[model samples]
Target: MIAEYADRVWRGESDDSIVDQGMEGKGVKPIVDGVGWWSGFGNVVAFEGSGELALFDTSSPFSAAQLHADVRAWSSAPLTAAFYSHGHIDHVFGTGPFEESRRATIYAHEAVAARFERYVLTSGYNAVINQRQFQAPGLRWPVEYRHPDVTYRDSLTVRQAGVTFDLFHAKGETDDATVAYVPEHRLLLPGDLFIWVTPNCGNPQKVQRYPREWVHALHRMAALDAEIMLPSHGAPIFGRDRIRQALLETAEWLESLVTQTLDLLNAGARLDEIVHTVTPPEHLADRPYLRARYDEPEFVVRNLWRLYGGWYDGNPANLKPAPDAVLATAVADLAGGAARLADAALDALSRGDERLAGHLAEMAALAAPTDAGVHRVRAQVFSTRAANEQSLMAKGVFTWVSSESSAHANRLGAPE
Candidate 1:
C-alpha cells in the first residue's frame, strides 16, 4: 500500500526511508484497496477480489520464499490464480509459493512449456549468456520450472465471483508473454511488455523478439485506457492519460524503428548499413524513460534484420565468412601489422567513430592476442567506448571487452 517506498526504490532514495517505512528490503506496495505489487527485482502483482487473491508473476525462486512470506502477511487469503507473465526464469521459478494452493491454478501461454523445456536442455549455455548479460559471473540458470496447468491460445477471461480477469497474449520480450487486465478496476498488468524503460525487444544473446508485434501489444493495452499499469520490471504507472501515452509512445518508438529497418531491408541495405544509419526519433528517444538503459536501438535493428533476412544480412561475404583469426590476420597484414591496426583503432576512437573503432579494435586484439601494446591500446579504446554508451547492455559488453584486454596485459606483466 506504500507507493512512497516503491517510488524511493526506483528513484535511488535513502535506505532509511525504506526501513523507516516498514519495508525492510522488499518493495511491495498496494496499488488500491486490495491490489498490491511486490517489486523485489522483478514484480509480483497481487489482486484481492472475489474473496480470494490473484497474483501476477511469482518472481524468481531466489526471492519466492520472501514473497510468499510477505504476501501471506498481507493477507492469508489463498491464492486463487497465479499468472505466469512469461517463460523467463525470473517470472516462473517462484511458483513454489503457490505450489500447495489447491484453489490456485497456474496459467500461461502454450509456448511457455516449450520455453521451459528449452531452458532445461540449454541450462549451461543460458547460464553463460545470463552471466555476461548481467555482469554476474556466478549467476546460475535454473532447471526447475513451474509449468502452467491452464494454457490459452489467444485470449482468456476468467470470472471469479464478482471480478473478471482478462488475459491477452503478445509476443514482445518473449514469445510466451501475457498482459493481464482488470476491467472492473481499470488496471493493467503488462509483464515486461511495457517496462518503464525502452521495450526489451532487442535482447542480443536471447531468442528473437517481435518488435512490430510488441507495438501492437502496447496499442492493445493503450486502447484499454487502463488508469494504472503495473509493469514487471519498474514502478507502477498511474493515471489513464499517462498510462495511454506511455503505452502508445512505447509502441510509436517501436514502430519508428521497425519502419526504418524494414525500409532499408526492402532497399537491399546490408546489416552494417542499417545498424549505423537508422536514426531514433529524437523527440521520443531522449525521454528519461525511453533512454537506452537496457537494450539499445542498434541491437533492435540487428534483431529486425535477423527476423526478416535471417543471418545472411543480404551480404554474400558474411554467409560463410573466413575465421576471425584469418580475417584479422588478413586485415592486419594489409595495415602493415597488428600494432598498426591498434594505432588505427585509436585514431578512429579519437575521431568519435566508435563503430569503426570497435571493428578495428576487435581485429587488432584477435590479430595479436599476445602482444602487450595491442592489448593496451584495445583496452583503452574499448574503455572509452564503454564510457560513451548509455545502455546497460552495451556498457556491459564493451566493459567486458576492455576487461579481457586488460587481462591480457596482466598475464604479460605489462605496467599499469
Candidate 2:
C-alpha cells in the first residue's frame, strides 16, 4: 500500500496526503531485504544484520516510543548505532526510547552540537515562530537535545554487522544535514534534504538556508545511483532511475533559483526588483518532487539575497524608516483620513489586487489604531490573502496577521 502511494506521488497523481502520512505514526515496513521504514513526523530507516541494527534518524520525540515499538516488532536485534540525519529535534530525539534497552552510539556532523546550542539559546523564540509557522498555538520548543556521541567534519564510514554505512555532511535545510549511503544495499538516506516537497531552503521564519550548497548536495546524492531512497519526511522511492531523477531535478530547481537571483544581483538590481524579476524554471514546474507546498521559490530568492548580499534592500527610506504607525498616519492625512485609506484598500480588494489591498489595509489599521472597522477590513484582506497562498509558510504568516486584526476587532468592537 505504501509503495503504491509512493508511486502515485512520484507520478504527481497523489495530493498532499503524502506529507500527511509522514506526520502520522505507522508500523515499520520493509523497503528491501534488511531495511525497515517507520513513518512518522520524521521517518526512521533501520538496517538489520547479524542480530544487530543500525538506524538512520531516530525520529521526533512525539513518535519516539512508537518508533521504538514499531522497529522492535520488525526486529529483536539490539541497535548497534544510529546516524542522525540532522540536528532537528524530530530526527535526534527518538534515540532515548531505544537506549532504554541498549546503549547505542550516535553519530552526526560536527555542526550538530552547535545547532543544539543555538536551539537552547533561542528556545522561546523558536517556540513562538513554530507556533506561527505551523499554526500550533502554545507549541513548546525543546531546550535540551541529544548531542552526537561521534562527530565528523565532512564524511565518516562505520560498519555494523557486515553492513557499511557512509555518512556525508552538506548544508541544506540546516547546516548539519547528513546523507547516509549503504553501498551494499544500494540505499540512500537523505534526511530533510529531500522532504518530498520543494527544498525548504526558503523558510521565512527560520535562519538562512544554503540554497547553493543545497544544490551541490543534491547533485552529489544524484550521482550515487541508489536503488532505494528513504527520506526523513516522506515515503520511500524505489528504482535507481526514480531516485536519480528526483535528486537531479530537485537540484536543478534550486540551482535555477540561485542562478537567477545571482544574475539579477550582479546586474545591480535592487532586492525588490530582483524578487519580482527572477522566476523558477517553467519546464520543471510540473515535476512531482518540485512543488512548492511547504516553501515557495520567492522565499528562496530572498534568502539568497541575504546570503550573497547584506540586509540593506536598496531602499534608503527603508534603511532608516519611520515607525509604521507614524508613516501610516502621515499617508492617511494626505489621503484625507484613515477611513479613506480603508476604503481604498477595499477598492484594491475589489480589483483583485490583494497585494495592494494588504498594504493599504495595514496602513489604515495602523493609522487608526482605535478603529475596529479598519481592523475588520484588515482581517478580511489578510484572510483572503492567506486563503490564496500556496505555501504553508506564507499561509501561516498571513493567517496569523489576519487573526491579529480579528482580535483587535473583537476587543475594540466594530463601529455601528
Per-model TM-score, in order, reads 0.91, 0.96
lDDT of candidate 1 at residue 278, scale 0 to 100: 91
- Write the residue-wise lDDT of candidate 1 on 325-353 in tens digits: 99999999999999899999999999999
Which 10-residue window in model 2 sums to the lowest lDDT? 15-24
lDDT of 2 by residue, 335-383 (tens): 9999899999999999999999999999999999899999999999999
lDDT of 1 at 316: 85
